[model samples]
Target: MGETIRREWRVEGMDCAACVASVTRAVERLPGVSQVEVNLMAERLTVSLAPGASVAAVEQEVAALGYQAAPLPAPDAAGSAAVPGAAGPDRSEAGGHGHAHGGHADDPAEAGKPWWRTGKAMLVWALGGLVGGAYLLSFILPQGQHWLFLAATLLALIPFGRRAIALARAGSPFSIETLMCTAALGAVVIGAAEEAAIVVLLFAVGELLENVAAGRARAGIRALAGLMPRTALRRRADGTTETVPADRLAVGDLVRIRPGDRVPCDGSIEEGRSALDESPVTGESVPVARGPGEAVLAGAINTEGVLHVRVTRAAADNTVARIIRLVEEATASRAPTHRFVEHFSAWWTPGAMLVSALVILLGPLLLGWDWQTGLYRGLAVLLIACPCALVISVPAAMASGLSAGARRGLLVKGGAALEAIGAARTIAFDKTGTLTEGRPRVTRIIAAEGAAETEVLALAAAAEAGSAHPLARAVAAAAAARGIAIPPASGAGAEAGRAVLATVAGRRVAVGSPRYGAEAARGGLGKLAAAMETLQGEGNTVSVVLADGAAIGLLAFRDEPRPDAAAGIAALAALGVRAVMLTGDNARTGAAVGGALGLEVKAGLLPDDKLREIAALRGAGPVVMVGDGINDAPALAAASVGVAMGGGTDVALEAADAAVLKDRVTGVAELMALSRATLANVRQNVAVAVGLKVAFLATTLAGLTGLWPAILADTGASVLVTLNALRLLGWTPRL
Candidate 1:
C-alpha cells in the first residue's frame, strides 16, 4: 500500500530491439516498479513505480543492462512535452561508448565537423589503410607477410572487442556485439585475417552511415517543437504591452498578436480580424479568417491585421502542445508487428548463434570441408543474421505514420490504434454535429386556433429555458431573436429524448416531441397531429407545446447537413467501408439526413441502444464510431476505434480512441486513409527487413556471400526501411 509515481528517462546504447528488451527486463525486475515501457524509436523509457523505489534505482538497473539512463527534462509551464530527437540522440551519450550508433554525435562543438574526423570513423579508415597496404605488400614480400594481416585484424577488433568484454562482465554475454566479435575472431582463427580486417572496417562504416540516416528520419519529429514562438506580447489592463516568455502566459490574459506574428497561446479573438494560417495545426493550405469569439491556436501565424486575443488555455495545454504529445505517445505505443519482432528477437539472437555453432561443426563433417573453411562459413552466417534491421523496422514506420497524421489534424492515440484503423470495416457516425451541423434552428412555427405564434413560442422557450438539449436551445434562441418575451417559469425539468416541463402562467407547460404533448393533453392534439406529420415528413424535428391539457403549438426545427457530408460518405464507401448513421432523432429525421448523405440509418436510439448497435457492428470487423455528444460516449468506447469530433463534449472526447481536430466529417476518411497507408508502410518495412535477412542468411550459409556482403546487407536493410518510413511524413491522400 504505497503511492505510485511515473517517471521518464532517456536511455542510450540500444542498437537493436534486443537491447530494448534487455533494458526493459532489467528495469521491470526492480522492487515496486509496476510498469516499464521502452520506446526504441524515441530512445526513451517510462516507468511507473511505487514510492519505495527511487529513480536512481531505475537508472542503475538500465545501466547494468549495458545502457545509460538519465531523467528527462522537467516539463515547462507552457506544457510543451519533450519530443523524441528534440535534442538529437540519447541523453547519456551512450555513456562514453561514443555515438557510433546512429544519433547526434557526442561533442556539441564537433557535431559540425566531417564524419571522417570522428574517432570511430578515423579508426575504420586507419584499419582500412593498414589492411590494404598489407594485401599489396604480400605480392612483394614473400616472408611472413601474413603477420601484417594478423596485426591489422587485431587492431580492427579493438573497439568491438572492448564492447564484447564489457557486455560479458555485465552478464549479457550474448549480444549483437558479441556475435560480431565472435565472427571477426573466428575469421582470424580460420586464417582469413585480411577478411576479418575488412569485415570489421566495413561494419564500422556501415554503422556510421546508419546513424546519419536514422538521425534524418528522426529530424521530422524534432521540427514540430520549433513551431511556437519563444516570446509573446502581453496586453496588460493598464493599456501597456510587455513582451514575455510564451510559457509565462496564463489563461484570461490578453495578448496582442500583430500581423506576421505567430499566436502565442490558444485563445479567442476579442478585437480586430485577421486571416490565420493554421497549416501547422490542421495542414490546411489556406488561411482561415478569425474574428471576435473565433478560436486561434498557438503556433498559427496571424497573416494580417492586429488581433487582441484572450488566452483561453496555458501554453502547455494548447492545441499545438497536445498534438505534439499525441504524436509522441502514439510513436511510443507499440503495434502487434513491433511486439512480435521483439519477441522473435528474444530467441532469435541465441538461435542464430547456435546455428553458427552447428555450421562450424557440421560443415567440415558433412561437406568434406577443412576446419578453416567450416569456421569461415560459420562466421559469415553469424554476421549475416544480426537482426538489427528487423528490430528497427516496425518502430520507424509507426513513428512516421503517427507524426504525419498529427500534422494533418488527425490525432491517432497510439501505434495500436494506428494499426487497428487499417482493419476498420464499418464506421458509425452520430447524426447531429457529426453528419449535420450541430446548430439546429426553428424554421417553422404553427400555432393552434386560439394560440398566437409569438405567445406559443414565448411559452415554449420559457419551458425550455433550463434545458441544454440542442432542440430546446434552438427554440430558446429563436424566441430571443424574435423579441418575444419569455414569461417567468418554475420547476423546469428535462426528460431525456422527450420533453422539458415547466409551469408557465399558472399552467403546466410542456415542450418536447409530439408524443409528449399527446400524452400530456390526453389525446386532444388531433388538429396538430397532421401538421406534426407533415413537418416530420419534411425531415424537421417538430416540438409540441402543451398547456393546461391542450396543445398550444408545434415548432419545427431543422439541422442542416454539412456540405461535405456526402463527400465524406462517398469517400468511405469508395474505400470499401460501410457508413452508418446512429441518431437519437426519430426515424424520419434520421432517414432524411441519411438519405441525403447516402448512408444507412438507425434512428430513435437511446445511449444504451447506440452502445448495443456498436457492439453488434464490431462482429463484422473493426468499427470506428464517430460522435460529438455525451450520448455517444458509450458507443465510442464500444467500437474498436472511437473518433470524436473536435467540437464534441469533453466526455465524448475523453472516451474516444482518436479525435478529428478539424471538426470535419471528411477528416474521418482522411484519417482512415492515413491509417491504411501507415499500416501498409509498416508491412513494407517489415517485409524489407525480414526479406533481406533471409536472403543474406541463405547466401552466407552456402558460402556464396562473405562477411562484407553480410554486414552490408544488414546495414543496408536498416537504412532502406528507415528512409522508406520517412516517406510517410509527406504522404497525403488525393482526396
Candidate 2:
C-alpha cells in the first residue's frame, strides 16, 4: 500500500465562485481527503487522499453538492489516453447543471445549431415568446382577456420556479436563481408582469453566454494535452521493427524517427543526423542540429534527416510529462495575493446579502417609495453581489502564467516561485557549468627538475579516474585522447578543497592546489614559483604536482565562457537585476570570466563563503542563486530563491526552488519577463473585477440601474477578466 496518492478529475456544474467554495467544503468533509484544489477556469479538481481511499466516495460528495466529478483519462502504454474507470458523460453534452438559468446549457451535440434549432433553448424562447405576444395583445384586448397575459407569465416561470424551490430546500436560499424567482413573483403581485418576464429572459440568456466563455477558457489548457504523439516505430536488435506506444518505451530502447515526425521520447541520437524544431519544448523558434550523441527532448519535431534514438527516460518521466504535471499543480500553490483574495471573498457574499436585506427594508421608508419598487431595486443589488468575477480573477491569471512558463522550459515550482522570479533584485551565479562550458582543457604542463611531463599527466589522470568532478573528467579525457595509458593507483583519496592523493607506480603522488603541493613537498617549490605565476596571470588554473615529497610539475587549464553568457548578463542588467559570480576557483580565473561577462566577482571562496555572500546580497533585496553543482547546493538554499540548470547535479536540482530546463543563462531572463508579465496581468484583472462591482453597486442604489443592467454587468465582468488573464498565455519575452 502507498502512503498517499493524488488524483485529478474534471468537475462540472460550477457556475460561480460560490459553487467553488461549496464543492471544496463538501469534499473536505470526506474521511480521508486532504489538500483539495479546485480551478474554476479549468473546471478541474485535484485531491490528495490516504492510500486505499475510495475515489467513488469523493465523487459522490461532489455530486451531493450539485456538481459532477469524474476521473480524468490516464495516458497509457500505447500512448493514447484511456478513461481511468468508466468515463462519465461529457459535461458539455449533458448541458448545464444545478441552477443554470434557461434550464439548459450549451449541448455539445447542438453546439453549432442556431438559437431556434436547439431544443431546450427553443422551448425557453417559445415560452418567452408566448408571454411577450400576450402582453402586446393585452393593449388591444378586452378587460376580460387581460388575465390571459397573466397565464402566459405562469408558463414561462415553470423552469426557473421549479429550480428556485429545489435550491431553497437544498439550503441555498439566496442563490441567484432563487432571487430571480422571488423578483418575478413580486412583479406579478405589483402589476409589473411584463417587466418580470423580461428580467427572467435576460438572466437566462446572460448565463448561457457566461458558460460559453468559461468553456473557451478551459480549452486553452486542454490544447497542451494534444501535442503528444500516439504511436512510435520501435526497432529491435534483430533488424526488425514494430509499432509501439510512445509511453511504453524504456531506457536504452531504440526508436526510429523520420522527417516530419515528432520525437517519441527524451533520448540521445544513436545514428544519423537531423535538424530538429525544438520550439514546442523550449519556446524558441530556431532549429537545432542533432547528430549522433546529441540529446533530444520529446515533443520536438524531426524536421530533416532520419534518426535512430536510444531512449534516456521512461515516457511518464519525459520532459513533456513534467510540463503537463507542473501546469496542473500550479494553482495548488497560491500566491500571497491570491490567498488574501480568497480570504477576503469568504465574507464577501454574506456581507453582500446582509447589505441587500437593508436595501429592501430601509429603502421604502427612507426614500418614500412603495414596497414593490424597493423590493425590485434590492433584487438588483443581490444579482450584482455574486462575487464571481472577484473570486476567479487571480487563479485564472495564475494558471495561464504557469502554463506559459512551462511551455518555454522554465519550470517554476508554484505561484510563490513565479512571484519570486520577478521580485529578484540580485542574482548570484556559480561560475563553472552555469556561466561557462564547465569543460577545462590542459593548456600547458611544466615539468620540474628530474621529472617528465608524461609522468605528471599520467599520475593526475590515474588519481582523477574515480572522481566525477568536471575538472577531473576533463583531465582524464585529455589523457585518453592523447593515447596515454593510465596506471592503476592504490589507496587513492580526495582532500576537500585541496587535492587528490594516491600511490602510482609505488610512488606517492598528489595533484591539487599549489599550497597543498608545497606543503606536501616540504617547501621545495621556490624554483617553479615564477612559472606558476605566469600561468595564473594568464587566467589559467595552475595545479601543482608533488611526488614523494618533491615538487615535480605544474599543469595549467582553461575553461571557456559560454557563448550566451555575456548577452544573458546584459539582459538581466537591463531588467535592473545585478549579476554576481560566486566561485571556488582562484581570484584570477574568477575575475577573468566575470570581467568577460561584465559581472561582480567573488572568488576563491569555499561553499560556506558563498553562502555568506548570498545572505549579504539578500539584505539589498530578494536574491536568486543560479548554480549547477553539488558544491553550490548550500548557496542555492541560502538565497531567497534558487535556480538550477537542467544539466546540473541531482542534488542541485532538488535544492533549488526552480529549474531552467533549457540549460542556458538566457532562461533566467525569460523567467523574469514572464513572471513580471503575470503580475501585471493579475493587477489588471483585480482592477477590472473590483472596479466594475463598485461602479455598478453604486449605480443600482441610486435607482439608475435595473435588473437587466445589473445582471449584464455581473456576467460581463466575469467574461472580461477571463479574457484579460489569457493574455499571458501567448506572451513572449521582449529579449
TM-score on alpha carbons, each prediction: 0.90, 0.85
Provide the overall lDDT of each model, using Cα atoms, as 2-decimal numbers: 0.77, 0.75
Return the top candidate by lDDT: 1
lDDT of 2 by residue, 330-443 (tens): 655788878888888767767887888888899999988788778877777777777777877887787778877777767776788888888888899998888988788899
lDDT of 1 by residue, 1-735 (tens): 877988988674444455666567667777888788887656679989897787888887665554567688776755444433444332222222233432222343444445456554566677779888888888888575767788887877776676566556545667566777788887777777777778777777766656555555555665676677878999878989999888678889999999999998889899999999988877666788889999888888999999999999776677666677667777778888788887897677778888889988998999888887778878887876678778888888888888787777777888888888879999999987789888899999999988899988999998888766677789889988999889999988878667778999899888867667777776678788898888988999888888877898899999999888899999999999999999877788888889999999999787788888998988888999998745577788888988888632244335567887667788899999998998898889889988887888888877788887877767778778878988998988767
Question: How big is the positional error of residue 16 in model 1, measured in Å on the Cα after superposition?
Answer: 4.7
By summed lDDT, the worst window of 10 consecutive residues in model 1 runs over: 90-99
Clashing pairs in 1: 78-315, 78-316, 79-316, 102-211
The true-versus-predicted C-alpha distance at residue 581 of model 2, in Å, is: 1.6
Of candidate 2, the 10-residue stretch with the lowest lDDT total is: 82-91
